[model samples]
Target: MPLPDGNNFIEKFAKSFYNLFDTPATIIKEKIVAPNQKTYPWYHQKFRRVPTIDQCYTDDPICVFEADMQYRRDRQVDSEILSILRQRFEDCVLYETPDHMEKCKHLLQQYEEGSTDWFTKYGDLGAYHDVKVAYMKQKHRMVWERRHGPVGSGMKEN
Candidate 1:
């Protein structure tokens, strides 16, 4: 069905805006996963710990996996996808999993340029990757400074 007059503008705008956010990553995925793998590398288009059967996406092929093992226990963000990603990096620089944009730069640089030293600077723990992602997670989680007030809601103390 066709939208009529001004009513259609909102609907059209919404579709366009959604595309603007989802397009860049998908386009890059197509480029990087082509030839051997040519499908979306996204599972549900939302933040998830593991990719589902439906995602059918190949992991990023550019980064080289590491053989040495490094493990830490306190962190809860350590999903299998994260470990798999760890193996994909030469220096084990898998800062953000499930798509983390670098502040405002490439919006899709993935690893921190040639090195994974970014982890030493800012280890991941549901931190903001960019404005868009921050907005989305904040919108979804309604980020609070603490559970009741003081702390303990996965927030830092200060």
Candidate 2:
């Protein structure tokens, strides 16, 4: 059958346009797999490698911020005694308005001592490095578990 005068060009153009986005048909083939062969389902993507923790990048702004934040968090946790003493001192000062100078003196002393002890223990580069290392280790584990399933689940590792 002959296409109408203008319909032929329009039909050809429309077909070509549609074909631009259409996926090409693939030929199906049969394959024989041995019993020992391992194959993943079609939906599964390529194998992913286990996550690794990299060293801290001091020059990078994002890395610097993360490292500093981690250090401060760990330091705060380890200095729980200092934080308690400081909070007590603040509470005393806030409660005793007029006699705070004398009434809160003991708390002030305790807070100062706690602060000194904390500084002596965890106020150095060694402490910061320790915190960063521990944080990175934890992040690596969490990322690996999230990407691949839990360890010992028989997941293939690349």
Candidate 3:
């Protein structure tokens, strides 16, 4: 049925305002997902799927920030190792191959066996413990800089 004609200016204004803001029942119904009473593949049902990285970008800001930080940290660690290796070996070409893979395997074995003479066995390319300590210090500095707007910025460390 058609709405009754407004009797006065106040009624007309009220009707107009209600019409502007009121949502149709059909539209609200369309938004609601009714639970499936029967298990059927053809029926419309809400299915939960794992969120992709693109979805995470908009959905979780903290997760995205943490992932970016981890990526940067890993890149810095790799760069440090490469820089040290290049400084020690002038003509060394670092590439992954079966031989290199075997060398890594052997190194891991030696490390697990409590051998600390890796530099003697594999040339003077610095100790693994020293490299790890340096990486951790660098990473700590990067995190501190990010949180406190860089060192020497008049921000006293506490």
Candidate 4:
């Protein structure tokens, strides 16, 4: 269908003015090709830019915020793994009493190994980040599947 012709002076003038520009198609194409916030890493997504470690530590607010968020998440994962090992070690030590040093030695060693290993699991940030993001995606998928039943299953609600 043809668009309606502008009926008023201002509308006609605006329409004619905008029609003078012939770059809307290219503008739209550029927008479609641009890297959006969703494509960025979760931590620094707001700024749509990658910041170096030096920038993060040197008072760049966006970088600082991203670093802080990452630190907290890393600490949380570390704590979850370490706390379990720590609890087992403490329990073994508690029960062994006089022989705790010798009897609980293995548990102590495991705890230490776990604590150290957590940091070096993937040996690099890129691998660790990929795993962590994959885990989050899986967790969300599981939750959604639980609520709606598996994809392609006939039990989903409308």
Mind giving the per-residue lDDT tens digits that candidate 1 earns over 1-158?
A: 87676588778899889999899988887777565663567763333233222232335322111100111211223444345444555232255543443332342233334124334322443443432332343344433533434223455546
Model 1 — TM-score against the truth? Answer: 0.19
Candidate 3 lDDT at 7 equals: 65
The lDDT of model 1 is 0.41
Candidate 1 ranges beyond 4 A from true positions: 1-7, 36-158
- In model 3, which runs have C-alpha deviations exceeding 4 angstroms? 1-57, 91-158
The local distance difference test score of each candidate is: 0.41, 0.65, 0.49, 0.66
The lDDT-based order of candidates, best leading, equals 4, 2, 3, 1
lDDT of 4 by residue, 16-129 (tens): 777677467667656875644246455543532454334455556776566546555565668788899999999998988998999999999999888767644423345345
- Please give me the total number of clashing residue pairs in predicted model 2: 0
Q: TM-score for all predictions?
A: 0.19, 0.34, 0.23, 0.32
Candidate 3, lDDT over the whole model: 0.49
Looking at model 4, report the run of 10 residues with the lowest lDDT sum. Answer: 45-54
If candidate 1 were superposed on the true structure by all CA atoms, what would the RMSD be?
23.4
**Taking the tens digit of each residue's C-alpha lDDT, what string does model 2 give over 95-115?**
998999999999999888878
Which of 1 and 4 is ahead in lDDT?
Answer: 4
lDDT per residue (tens digit) for residues 1-158 in model 3: 65567767888899877877675654555565344234557755533334322335556766555554544454455555655544433322244343555545544443433223322222333444333343455567678778777656856556
Candidate 1 collision pairs: 65-87
Name the lDDT value of residue 7 in candidate 4.
65
